[model samples]
Target: MDELTLRIYPSVRAAAPDLETPGLAGYAFARHAWLQAWADTFGAQAHIEPAIVVMAGVRIQMVLPLGITRRNGLRTLEFLGGIVTDYNAPAIDPDFARSLDATAVQALWRRITAALPSHDVVCLTRMPVTLDPPEGAVGERVPNPLALLPGVNAAGQARSVTFPDRYEALTGTLRPRFWADTQRCRRRLAEVGPIAFVVADDDAGMRALIVSLKRMKSRRWRETHSKDWFAVPAFSDFYDAMARIDLPEGRIHGSSLNVSGTAVAAHLGLVYRSRFYLLLIGWEADGWRRFSTGRLMTETLLRQAFDEGLRVFDFTVGEEAYKDDWANALMPLVRYDEAITARGRFATVLMTARDRLRARATQVAWLRRIVRWLAGRPLA
Candidate 1:
């Protein structure tokens, strides 16, 4: 085996040429375009640093889009996309991923870890365990190289719906109740006005829809007393930049469900490698709640996905009830939280305790309600 050489780039743009090489599943989120948008907008605060590995210092092997941040006085290294990027993984060749033995993988991992700059801890989340190949038979699964590293299961499982080659066959796979509800929702929504699903093709339309989605998401977060991530200027800016840019491997796509010529529900998603990644979605807070505009929009998008011959529609990272209702399978993503120093160990302990308490609070209905009320959230 040839020795692998690991190199670190200060920014995603610096690593753009190498990242363009599609690896394994050709994950869109890990591509140069997506991560570069993030780096350009938020890298200054986060200290974005991407790492790549090559054999004999020539052929690209892996791309780890990494960044650094400080929390509770502890400097932590994490994936560049943060929580927005659903799957935090390195892009690797399929053959190399499945062929490497445990010893070889750990050596590569150690080299990558050693190359990382000073940081208290390293945390990578949403690492996929199985990946689909581009030329393999339909539904064939391949081992992911990231799984070789030791890690624990993440809090929430990622869910996705796989579609057949044809639209009718894909629709036929939906559960009877789900299919019936979708039909009913469409009928009710149509009664109010003609419902149309529109794709934002131009940059201006895409930017406007992105802003609308942020507002709608903010409204929902305020209602639920959850942190509004979109409120952060960097996150909003990242999406805004992504909406205008197009990548050869994939591009940001905005779709909307308009009723009576009014945009009721809209989603900004990514189309890559014949797969659709549902990133952000929002619905108008008018009289469309009863009509389930969100659900209708999702259904319409699935139909479009089928029409486009997309093999998968990923809901990304979440444990929402509606996601379970639509997803046929769940993909368990793992998290990597390694302590590199004494301070890191203490920080990791504190973080684990805080996470447990937060999880418990979410489990108790009264506690959650109380917290929401305390946060000034309106509850009916």
Candidate 2:
């Protein structure tokens, strides 16, 4: 194996030249504006630092924007975006990525692992296995090359919709049941009022939709007994800042599904290259459940995106049933956990055991109920 030069930057601003990496810019999550927003917004509290790695002076082999925090008295390292960031792999150039064999990849990991600043354990979640573009598309297809890194398949996988040139062809390719269901959903929604789909025309419009999405998500979380992530001021602020970013290649995009004159559903996502990353989506809670407003909004957004010539609608991460019904492809994402110290090793064992238990809990309803119950207070 040839020796490779590794350079580490303390922050994204310090990693300017490497962030301009050619060939990989379009799909590189580290280069996305949202990342920088996340770093600055959550920087102080999270101790987030950009650990972007550049190889041989000019080539960006991998970029890991990381954050260091103390967990149970042991310093732990994790991806900056936490659970919200769907894909978390080092952005290696596609050509360089495809050429890597086991020995080369192992060597690469050695260099990356050695550079971390005194952390007990490192956890990078939602790392995609492949970087391949849609089939017949102009971009490259990476077949989960990063899975070669030491990691395990995560409990939940990512999902995406590969659109055809036309909307009719796209729906025609769906399962008959899904296609029929989609048609019925839209028809029923249309009967309630004049259906209108609108994309945010300005910053104010985008901010308004995002605020509405947060409210909708909070209500949903309460029903499921799940923590509302957007409740964090910094997280919501990071998203609001991302929505206002203006760039020629891409910027955060917001859209709404309106019934007559009211917004029944709102979505805020990123538009990069020719792909649409579906990030946050929510619908009005008042009597809108019967309309299946969220599903209808997704269908409307798909048609709009297809007509606009976007190739992929990435539902980001999660194994949601709705995503399975809508997406034509499944993008597998894995998690990497490594221990560098004795404390780290002990934590790793605990984490692994917890993961195994969680996986099993998903299979048994009584177990899931018990887990949720334990997560709450018994009585006042």
Candidate 3:
């Protein structure tokens, strides 16, 4: 109904001056404070270029927090938060978003992409089909406009569990055997000593728990021979800063499962929009492994979520087998990739080939062994 124009801003703050206003509606990750934290920590390496869509040359309609980086000699455009951000979507005005249909959204997307600065490839990932309204907002879920565009493909699935009126009712939804096993684990863990689940209530406590989480996670990654993103200073810094961020609708939540006054497992997450996002989790790997501390930690968190009147407990991304035991719903994630130059197309082909190879390696043991041998890495 109104003329739309796209403008590029060099930073997240410049793009949305009213970022902290309660009127902003979007997921927690798309919040200005979240994106700005990423920009501040990762700005040394990536260039932050956020695209803002304006309505009637006055009102801000949407903000696409994008960034550019030179990888393998080609400048590439992508969402600002990269792999750390679970759900990537634009912070759009709800009224404007509801007015646009698929056709109109696609046209607007094309215009936005065309106006972007010169780059080789545009890759936007981990977008959900629909966005839940902010905490206390009264409305149905809004359709994610980017998901309606062509060329989007299924990236993966994010798992979550919706809470019931009662915590016991939520537990009843799980398999009888699984719940029994979780309870057994709790009993076994308590035998070691008094078991308690603690949440960080102050900034000092939050930072301490985050530090413990990082130590445990890094150790686990090292033992498994996996690529440790936390080893990267920027990645670690981004998460550390996020743990301290305080927003009206969202706040960093850190908790630990303690045994005998010692924390054996820790989790760093976000409490936003009546949901608890299970982001980073780590557990003691030594003697506590036999007690299943990780599962116990998760159970404690779920109970706390219920007590707090949270609507959902989101496991975020990945298809880890443990998620299947507790997840009652799975949200499909999608990505859009487009190449603007020969280099970009070549990169795209390489990515596809690599994915295929990885998929095949998972199925064929010999191939996997050979690949590992060639790469001079041990099996994970």
Per-prediction backbone clash count:
0, 4, 0
Query: Where in model 2 is the C-alpha error above 4 Å?
Result: 1-3, 25-28, 57-61, 132-140, 143-145, 151-155, 175-178, 353-380
Give the total clashing residue pairs for model 2: 4
Candidate 1 C-alpha error for residue 279, in Å: 1.1
On residues 1-380, what C-alpha lDDT tens digit does candidate 3 reach at each position?
43666667766778556455455456788777787788788764565555544332456677677777776567778877777888988777777778788789888877777777788888888998877765567888777888888879999989999887888888888999989988898888888899888889998888889889999999989998998878899899998888878766878889999998899999998898788999999999978898889998998898888888899899999878999999988889899888889888887787777667778999999888766765633211
Candidate 2 versus the native: TM-score? 0.86
At residue 141, candidate 2 shows an lDDT of: 68
Note the Cα lDDT for every prediction shown.
0.75, 0.72, 0.81
lDDT of 2 by residue, 1-380 (tens): 25557777777677756665545622536664556666767765576655666665355555556657776566777776665567776555656667788667777777676776778877767777777442244655665555787555564677888887667887887799877876787788888899998888887787778878888888888878988878888777777777776544666779999989789999988777777888888888767887888988888888777887887888988666888778888776787777889988887786677667668999999888876775544211
Clashing pairs for predicted structure model 2, backbone only: 129-144, 130-144, 132-141, 132-142
TM-score of 3: 0.89
TM-score of model number 1:
0.87
Q: Candidate 2, which ten residues in sequence have the lowest lDDT sum? A: 132-141
**Clash list (residue pairs), candidate 1:** none
Candidate 1 per-residue lDDT, tens place, 93-201, comes to: 6666667776777777787777777888877777787766643435456667667776555555789988765666666777888889888988887888887888999
